[model samples]
Target chain A: MKQLTVELGERSYPIYVGEGLLNDIAATLGKHRIGTKSPLLLVTDEQVAKHYLERVKGLLEAGGYKVATAVVASGEKSKSLSVLEDIITVALEAGLDRNSAVLALGGGVVGDLAGFVAASYMRGVRFVQIPTTILAHDSSVGGKVAVNHRLAKNVIGAFHQPEFVLYDIATLKSLPDREVRAGLSELVKEGFILDREFVEWCDANAEKLLALDSAALEHALYIGCGVKAKVVSEDEKEGGLRAILNLGHTIGHALEAVAGYGELLHGEAIAIGMVGAARLSAKLGNPASIASETERILRQFGLPVRIPRHLDTDAIMGAMMHDKKFTEGSMVFIIPKDIGEVEINRSVSSVWVREVVDSLKEGE
Target chain B: MKQLTVELGERSYPIYVGEGLLNDIAATLGKHRIGTKSPLLLVTDEQVAKHYLERVKGLLEAGGYKVATAVVASGEKSKSLSVLEDIITVALEAGLDRNSAVLALGGGVVGDLAGFVAASYMRGVRFVQIPTTILAHDSSVGGKVAVNHRLAKNVIGAFHQPEFVLYDIATLKSLPDREVRAGLSELVKEGFILDREFVEWCDANAEKLLALDSAALEHALYIGCGVKAKVVSEDEKEGGLRAILNLGHTIGHALEAVAGYGELLHGEAIAIGMVGAARLSAKLGNPASIASETERILRQFGLPVRIPRHLDTDAIMGAMMHDKKFTEGSMVFIIPKDIGEVEINRSVSSVWVREVVDSLKEGE
Candidate 1:
């Protein structure tokens, strides 16, 4: 087993990465048990639970854990207030305790809903992520778990880190093609913001990784988690530099909101969001000359560049205001001055934003 | 107005205590609005909702905030999963947003429940406390808001600091004597764990402060918030030294669980819990003696020294295992060595705990 630390001082926890890490799940949770009777609960969405929930439960029960299960819907819509209450009520009715660890097993939706449940249930409880999707490579690693409120996505959440994250890449083989494509968006993000060489590697290794080539897939997982772990270590709560991770997300969330969410996967939204940002960067006259190159790479990965029809420009602008990063009403855009460098620049003008929206409309 | 900072770096926030803080509520919220749609949903219980909800809504609406209201049943019981879901659903249906702030207008239960909803809604939103009870003076000011999970008190919560805390002490004038005593338990925790001078002051001026004398109340508020703010600044998430703040919470929580919460006020349970802790501290031979004096001061404040007759020892022990602080089954006891000295001790034996229960049984 390979272990990485998130380095959050006291809130710090470990992320265990490797194949078959899921096999020893019970003994793993035994370490985080605080009280004598840790009435454990394993949370998964309906989709993932159909295949793997019983196996995970067996491992914990075999280790003598008194456990329970909570399963919700299997998509972004599941991240509503009703689902959160349902799971919380389940845990309470099952008599789960503060010392109890909530094992989130599914993709991003389950991890987030379960993590938010852990973050607020009994003030806070231990959360363990057994991320099943390639997209969870980012969401599960950072403690950014939350359910969406009506007006925004992830608008309400804490920077609560998990007790541990056990990423089993094998789980992704069962995922659909669209989901696999969605996962690539974060790798694209990692390449754009923190490491350019990693992007080049993704370019070279995309096919093998797509085919579930173990070595190639491991590299992406390792590098994606590596950059994310470092960033979360530096800023667990997004006080300043951490905002850079939202490089594509700012525009991406707007895209999702305009397209009415679930229309575009988180990564697809980000894929186009990155393009919008890249275009804005090129227009601002950067020294790196990073316009055509990024567009080509995105197209090569089969990522979309088309902004959805029927989406109003002003509506997207309004949605951008909902971002937690923005101050009062003034915008804080995390624009890259050059590739391999992202800055959380708060002094951007709305006029510049309007112009970019206009320029992109004609170009795409 | 007296202002103090919690000093949690970026998570750090300010506390405003004095007369008519609710009147200044709009101005305080103005500084943290994420958009022009800076409306608010004022959350309170049925009790405080009748008294201060309309007044607070009128103040905010008059000051130009698009205001709404959400009221729940008032009590510890209202902190359940169902109530939380109800509030989140109400807020969502009412168009609450990231730009919107939650004004928690009631005592500790309202502040904690509403604060938690803010902490988990859309991931999170900003919350401002318009505390209408004396207990809220301590609970609200420090940013430690939470709800009671089934097995333990304050089991589900987040360390999401409020955007601002408004300690309207004038609200304390209507507090019942029992509630006033309950609030003082936290105030007393500060003195017993960190401040000898404050403990001495409380012993000297408990009556004056209880009378709601402005000068005496201000002193207690200052000292209570100052100690908690300082501790929270150094350890916002209860990593290490923050555990010292637990002072009597472990045993106090156990007592409350055994006595069936709401049967005994939290402060009353904590008072008995402190005596139990003092006895354990003396037995541990950790030096510095004030076990007798601790009991004297608690009795003087009209607090209880024995767990209620309804409680069973073994049941209470089982409940402690569910405490958020429980590590496995062994208790993490926070014992007072002297008036100003406390420590978070791990692996407290169950054998000794039985002795403390036996000792309490002999007394009132």
Candidate 2:
């Protein structure tokens, strides 16, 4: 097992990466002082619950922890205020308290939704992340937990870090191909924003990593988490350095909002967004080769490289106008200068954005 | 103007207690770096907006700020999840951004609902509390912001402190007689749990304070905020010292929930709850004089000293069972030993709670 700690002072927690760590879940929780008598709520989605809920429940119960389950629908829709209310109500009904702990067991949706649940439950409680999909490697780590407002995604949320993140690679075997690709988009994002050699490493081992090669997957996730952990530890509130993590997210979030959430997965939209951002960088005199490289790498991973034909440029721009990144009518975009280098451009003109977005039409 | 600072390290802010601070609202906001260009949203209720919204907006506009208004209904109903969603949508529609600030311009309902709105918008934003009610003196200080859930009051919330708290005593001049009395209940509570001298002072000047004596009111608010500020500074997240601040809140919240929020004013319910807690303390071997003196002072302030006859004891007990203070099957209660001293009893029996609650009936 390989372990990395996100050093956040009192909020610091460990991320455990290995195959078959689920069996050790009880001992891991015990080490964190979560005893058998603690009121425990395990939040998951229908899909994840079907495959692994009983196994986790048996392990916890065997270790004498009385666990309650809150299974939400398995999609982005669960990241809504109504769904958040449901989880809170269920948690209350289960008799969870400030001293109680929540264990989120699923992909990013479950992690984000459940994390926010724990964050706001009686002004915050301890939560553990048992991420099943690769995408959760990003969502579960930073503690940027939130539910989507109808106006925009993650506009309503809080920065409450978790107790620990326990990732068992064996669970990845159950994820669909699309889900695996979605999770890798974030890994590629981590590499693009901070580590040049890491991007090269991802490109070299893309297939092996895609094939669920345990060693290759483990190395990618570890590097991805390490990059994010370092950035987050430096800027937990995104006052400065952490904004870079939103490299593709400015345009990416707009895409998700315009596409009417769940229609386009977060990672898929971000894949296209990263391409658009790179194109904008090239238009601003970065280098066309960098844009092409980003497109090529994303395509190799079976991710979209162009804006969907059905999406309207005007509508996407309208959505971006409401993004949290915009301040007093000016938008901030994270532009990739090269494969592993990025810069925050706060003065991106609407006309330039329109030109680049309009130019990304299929077959344009 | 007399000012008290809630010392929360980097999150510390001032509580300005005086008459007519609202006239200088712009200058006060400017001192906090909220200038003309800051994206500002003023959240108020219909009642407050009818009297003060335009004044505040005009003042801000004169100061070069582009201000937006979101007016919720003037009651506890506004502190619901749906209302919270409405506020977030309004904030987005108004083009408020990460750097934008929200100014809550009413009583506790507005302060709490708007504070939570600021706390969750883009993870969090700075919000100023311009409390217009006497009850707000307590809510504005502690930074315990939240909306009510259907199952309970304040079941879903966060401890997001304000940038500054501006209390203009002049606003209290417009409050109804009942509202004035309701606000005083919290002031009396501050005395019962922490300062016996303050209680005596309140008892001596109850009539003058109720008649809107500016000097007496300012003195009362300053003392109330000072007591709470000291307590909150010692325990920001209620790990230990802060629970004492919830002295009457355990059963007080239950009373509010059972009465169907807004049916019984918060201070009125807490006035009764404090009496019940005093009774419980006496039953658990404290001096009975403590209970009688508490009842006498509460009566002097025109606050209810017994549970409303209409509220069901069982329903109230059921509500208490789900309070955030409960852990597993056990409940924690703040029991008063004397006028100014209290202790947290973590092993309070439900049967004993039932006996005390049942005995508090007006007819009994």
Candidate 3:
């Protein structure tokens, strides 16, 4: 097992990366003094609950913890105010208190939804993340928990960090091919924003990683979580350095909102968004080769490189205008300077945004 | 003007107590660097909007702000999750961004609802409190923002402190007689739990305070807010010291939940809860004089001293058992030791609870 600690002073927690760690949840959580006597709420979605709920519950119950389960419908729709209200009601009905801890056991949707549930339950409670998918490697570690509104994604949320994140590579075996590719998009994002050599490593090991080989997946996730952990520790509230993590997210979130959440997976939209950002960077005088490289890498991962033909460019622009990241009326975009470098620019012209988005339209 | 600061380190903010400060909204907000160019969302209720919305908007606009308004329906129902969703959607439609500020321009409901909105919008933003009711003297300063769930009051919430709290006694002139008495209940609670002298003062000047005399109300709010500010500064998240501040809240919240929210105003329910706590404290070996004194003071302020006959004891106990403060199935109660001292007792027997609650029932 490899462990990395996200140093956030009193809020610091560890991320455990290894194969078969799910079975050892009790022991790992115990190391952090999360005892069997503590009331535990195990939140998962239908899909993940079907596959691993009992197994995980049994392990904790065997360790003397009384586990109460709340299984939400699986998908982005679960990240809504109404769904959050239901989770709170369920948690209260289960007799969970401020001393109780919530264990989120699923993909990013479950993690985000459950994390917010824990965040607002009694003004905040300790929660652990047992991520079931690769995409959650990003969401679970950063502690950016939220529920979506009808008009926007993550419009209502908080920056509540988890007690710890426990990642078991064995769970990756159950994910579908599309899910695996979605997870890699974030791992690739970590590399693109911080470590150049890490991107190169992912490019070389794509096949082994895609196969869900324990060793390759563990190494990729460890590196990905490490970059994220470091960034979050430095800027927990995104006052400055943390905004870099939103490199493709500005356009990416706009895409998700325009496409209607769940229609386009977060990672898939971000894959296309990263491409859009790269094109904008190239137009703004970054080397053309870097933009091509981003496109090439996304395509290699089976991720989309262009905006979907059905999406309206004008609608996408309108969506971008409402993004929470926008301050006043001006929009900020994270432009890639090169494969391993990026710059935050608020000076991107709308003419350039329109031009690049127009260029990606169908039959152009 | 009288001012008290809630010292929360980097989250510290001031509570300004006076008459006619609402007219000075622009100057005060500007002092905090909430500039004219910053986007502003003025949230109020239908009733408050009818009287103060345009006035507040005009003041902010005159100070250079581009203001937008979201008027929610008046009453506790506005604190529902659906109402929260509607507010967020309206704020987004109004083009609020990360740099924008939400000014809650009414009583406790608007403060709690809008504070949560600012807390969750874009992960958090600066919000100012323009509390127009006396009850807000308690709610606005502490930053305990939340929207209620169907099953529980403040069951879903966060402790997001505001930038500043501006209390203008002038607005209290328009409140109904019942609302004025309701606000005083919290003020008396502050005195009962923390300052015996303040309670005596409230007793001496009950008529003036009840009449909403500027001098009396300002003094009462200042002292009330000072005690609250001190307690909150000592314990921000209710880890220990803060629970004392919930002196009347455990049972009070239960009352609200059982009464179906709007049926009982928050302070009125708490007035009864404080009496119950005093009775419980006396039964637990405190002097009988304390209980009598509590009943006397509540009666002096036109506050209810007993649970309504129609309220089912079993239902209220059921709600209390689910309070967020419970730990390991043991309920903790803030029992008043004397006029100005309280003890947190976790060993109160359920049998004793039943007896005390039954004693408060009519025809007993």
Q: How would you encode candidate 2's per-residue C-alpha lDDT over A10-118 as one tens digit per residue?
A: 8899999999999999999999998776678999999999999999999998888888899999998889889889888888888887778889999998988888888
Prediction-by-prediction clash tally = 22, 0, 1
lDDT per residue, candidate 1, A127-149, as tens digits? Answer: 88899988898999879987776
lDDT by residue for model 1 (B64-103), tens:
7787778988788987656876787677666675567787
Ranking of all predicted structures according to TM-score, beginning with the best and ending with the worst: 2, 3, 1
lDDT of 3 by residue, B1-364 (tens): 9998999999899999888888888889889888766578899999999889988899888888888888999998898788888888878898888878899999999999999999998788889999998888888988899887777778788998899999888999999998899899999999888899999999999999998889999899999999999999999988788888888887888888898887788999998888888888988999989989998988998988788899999999998887777788787899999998888998888888788888877676
True contacts kept of each: 0.59, 0.84, 0.87
Native contact share for candidate 2: 0.84
Q: RMSD of each candidate?
A: 5.7, 1.3, 1.4
Interface RMSD of each: 4.4, 1.1, 1.1
Order the numbered candidates by DockQ, best leading. Answer: 2, 3, 1
Which lDDT value does model 3 have at B30? Answer: 86
Q: What is the DockQ of each candidate?
A: 0.35, 0.81, 0.80
Q: lDDT values of the candidates?
A: 0.77, 0.89, 0.88
* Model 2 misplacement above 4 A: none
lDDT of 3 at B296: 95
Per-candidate TM-score, chain A: 0.94, 0.98, 0.98
Number of the top lDDT candidate: 2
